[model samples]
Target: MSNSFSDMLKKNFNIDLNKQQKAAVSHKDGPAITLAVPGAGKTTVLICRTANLILNHNISPDNILSITFSKASARDMKERFNKVFGDFIKYDVKFSTIHSFAYFVINEYARLKGINFKLIEGNNTSLNKVRILKTIFHDVNGGYVNDDKLEELLNTIGYVKNKMIDISDYSSYTVPQIKNFNIIFNKYEEYKQRNNLIDFDDMLTLTLRILKSNPYLLDKYRNKYRYIQVDEGQDTSKIQNEIVKLLCANNNNLFVVADDDQSIYGFRGASPEDLLKFEQNYPTAKTFYMEENFRSTKNIVSVCNSFIKSNKYRYDKNLFTRNENKRPVTIVKTRDEHKQYEYIIKKLKQSDDLSDSAILYRNNLSFISIAEKLDKSNISFYVRDSKLHFFKHWVVNDIVNFLKLALNNNDVQAFENIYYKMKGYLSKAALRYVKEQDNSISVFDRLTTYPDFRSFQIKNISILKRDFKKLVKKRPFEAIRFIENSLEYGKHLKEYCKKTSFSYEGTKTILSHLKTIASECNSIIGFLTRLDELQALIKNSTAKKNNTVTLSTIHSSKGLEFKNVFMIDLIDGEFPSLGSIEAYEFGQVEDLEEERRLFYVGMTRAKESLDLLAINEKNEEKVFISRFINELEYIMKENDEIPSEFSAWMKIGMIINHKRFGIGRIMDIDGDIITIKFKSIGIKQLSLNLCIEKDLLKAANS
Candidate 1:
């Protein structure tokens, strides 16, 4: 605290630093970590701290380095800093993304060493990283690499490099379709070295190697940047942290702003564990907490604070707000997915302004149905990540081709698309032979005439012909079911997921959504037409550029806020994800905690009103609310009368005993309304609230 700097901050920026923020900004020496809660204005604190160093301590602007998570953020920081001190300061401060800084270091080191390198990654690069990886994948596995497998391979390789995993341990990491992934990794690295090529991940590894091997350069960098500030430290990978550690090794003037509770990027190899263990790395480091959230209402802050506490791996901190609670956090339960959409549509219709409202979901597929409904209702919306990959998915294509073949058995194009994906086991040679046959004959019937066909293949081809004859008479909905079940395409998808390391549940969810879309069509033509319309609608929705309601995945909604937020599809399998739940059950809770963090992030995005939407049934099957919701409710102690295991016991068709109505069989359950057929009182619908309030219901066996 210098009054001159404080006065300048108030005069120039019109900002008053909170006590914690002031402390964080004034601490100009030693390593420090600030645990900033969501919406706590850490960016402000970081900017002010950088200013504090320049103004009060008289630190050189050239000697200070500020690092952010993304290029946009770095640009925003620079703009904001210029707004605050552009007139007062003559020199410019350096602000960059860690990747950008690493590239700079690599460039400088290469210039000094006279080593020319070509970047094989990024949009500007001449060499395509994915194409190279695909070639390596084909060479290693001798199979056609699909998009999903290629994405998994790319992520796995990036994860290994970002985590700084040793070459010997690459085999332990599971990369589907390629058993000896190290061979591919080694070959890729060797190719890069031979060709003087480098990818994005190599930026860090190369920079680290240059710094470690060349002490003169390491000392040069350490002295060049005396004070370093890092934003979003929780999202920093281990290698990134190590690089920062080397940069600040001599000065130890590292200041990191992070919130471990918000660490949700574990899949990208971000190590919140490194953040949690900041003390071990710098024993003298001081930790500070900025737990005041300025962006949410008190109720929203309170519930999210309680919800995130369920994760045991996070640093303990409670987020509080001074803003009044405009409304209690709402838990809206709909009878089914369609009803959920109706509820959202009704709410949006009643709203005066759509720009301040948002509908957030865990998965991208969650938006397809609602987006369609919104368009049909003439409700405008902007999608944050408007990827219509569902319509273009391989599964969707396979199902469409199957239906096309069923509609016209002589469709050689359709046969060519799905022959390898089905149980017919037709080879390329057999396909070529089929093309040469009579155009009037069905592809399946023509397959039996191939001379190389086995007796079993002939039998399968005959069965497939019979199935297609039966499939032609079904509606589009039934046709999709036939393709999934009767045609055994679902079995193929399961194997595909296994071989590609793709998410089986997510694939099934996509198929389930496709079936939902198909249920509206009578003929296959109508279904195909509807798919085209939806794809076009989704693509065009992003181009509207209006201030309409936002449909965003929770991940995209981070660092954004809305006056009202509706988190839809808040069910067990959709939000927490089946993989997270299964891993939690097996005592591996890292994934589960990340899911919890995602839920917390979505909830805290609301400033005034927050609604958690769930459906009791989807596609005529029972579904439970997300455990995160129940955990938050339990934490708030809002439904004390309702037992902790209420979700487990409230099943459809379960026999129950009512204290006043005697033994009964549950007939149907929708939301919280339980319909039961009592032996003494006939069928009666009772609210769960009434049951819990009066202690009237119990499991008969219990």
Candidate 2:
């Protein structure tokens, strides 16, 4: 049967299946899981397996069900399956997303039970989930919530539901804001129930409930989908796994295809632990590893396979590729982010096709400066995930309003915008009183004339008025500092964060980036104009979808391939993120592991060339390269059969061990000359390449 299937594949599609892929495709019974590595052709194996089940095993097409995590994946699978079979099969197999399948079960059950529920999410609903959440937030917290906070809240809710955590145990999770998070959670659920509405998460939870409650419906599905296959199994949440489990209980034929190394969505409640524990769930299940990468070069595959070994909680498998080793993986270090941008621009110009290159980053903000640089260089590019939230942040608005009030004290609108955000404890009533006064006088002065004001309030108002006068004479950058430090606006933000449970560090980071932008502007007008120009550039870049280089966050770049991949901002705090490092320090290793997986995913995206870029300094402060990069270096060095002549891992401030001089710290590196400060031998200058070739120096263990 396998030989015949191979012949058919070769004759029709001109493709040959590897041994592991063939094994995965031929496993037609019982329970099995395939650990499909990146670019291992899991989707092709899945389609072939589906066909194998039908043509060889004589299974009915309607009895087979294939589920993926996304609509895009499901659509791609269906289209590819149709193209592969091309009317050779009589019936179409059922291909659906877990959500779509759940909705099908829900609609069937709802119709039978005569239950009506309006979806509060998606375009069909009159009720807006975000609006309801915002109102609930404002009612409870008594302040405006930014898009970031709102997004965090929505994700927390989804995480809770997807993880099947009880509302009673909501506090156990590190949910955002709302000390009474359970209250908000319950309120949202209650509001939906009372209004006869449901959300996207409810689709899963309700389907699970219906399945568990109605044995007849459960048996019907279990019998219908005699053979069930799930794609991207590593990204399946607990609830999703449970639904698949119950449906596959009767026939015991379940095929889950996943790569735990690429499981980077733990924040969304996706757990690779379930994938690892597949045997525990199905004792007879066999696991196959499709570790042959068909996308990246052998060098990329080798380096990334070694790099991902640092992660502790993954299936032990090496990803190998047959593609030519076109170039060794390059590590480019620059003086700062600007130099990094210059390096990227130079490379893009040298490339024959911009569409084959990509600039990937760990965060969305990393693309802003690079996007500006690309636009200035007249290099067309497309941002996969462009977020203008930074420009639209309330902090940006408050800073602008502060500048406006400084330029014109009589600007009533600007005063109203920032009065409450400042150190002055201005109330709604006080603001109303000021609005009724003449617009010619300073609103701060008008605030002092309020009859109900306390003595301290009046004094603070006077001080604020004086601060605005001082601010008028300062440059844009200095004005930002004055507002933050001298005027106590930063303190106000800190206090607001404390009260609302918002992220003060994230808010401060936004202000810091704003300050950086301000440093480039001579005046407030210039700063404002720069902001508008950058935002417009980002917006316009999205339209240049074809014949342009791609800029994307690592998360968005999943399942994408590029000829040349440049991962920028590979610094400790920026790439691994301070939060992930802190979590690792606190004994939570999962976050750091996920960060490694994200980097690994970015690396494997390159088909021919990969460059990892880091900055030696950012904003005049010394910053180290990402520890992930350091780990990759160590892996490469350990795996090398013969010592390389040059050391790519050497950087300033890195501690090293010398065979003769004992322990030393790298003082500087100029061309081939390396100056090291040894503990026992004082300072010594050595040839960097000679040290590596002779194995005279090694990286000191942290």
Q: Say which candidate scores most in lDDT.
A: 2
Expressed as tens digits, the lDDT of each residue in 1-702 for candidate 2 is 379889999888887998888889999889999999999999899999999988988999999989998887898899989998858886867789999999899999989999887777854555778888888888776876788777778889999999999888877775454555677888888888887777889999999999999998999998889999999998899999999998998879999999999898877889788998999999999999899999988778988988898899999998898887656676666777777787788778988889999999998877777776787789998988687888888888889889988988888898888877777778999989989999888888898899999898899888988988899888888999899888789999999988866667667657766766776778888888988988887887776466799999998888889999999989987789888898899999988998999999999999987888877877556888899877766665565411122344566898988988899999976644689999998999987545633558888873
Query: For model 1, which pairs clash?
Result: none
Model 2 accuracy (lDDT, Cα): 0.84
- After superposing candidate 1 on the true structure, give the runs of residues whose Cα lies further than 4 Å from its correct spot: 123-126, 173-178, 386-388, 420-433, 444-475, 494-502, 520-522, 540-544, 638-702
Per-residue alpha-carbon lDDT of candidate 1 for residues 646-702, written as tens digits (9 for 90 to 100):
444456688899999999998875545678999998999987644643557889998
lDDT: worst 10-residue window of model 2: 639-648
Measured over all alpha carbons after superposition, the RMSD of each candidate to the real structure, in angstroms, is 6.7, 6.6
Tell me how many residue pairs clash in candidate 2: 0
Quote the positional error of residue 176 for candidate 1 in Å: 6.4
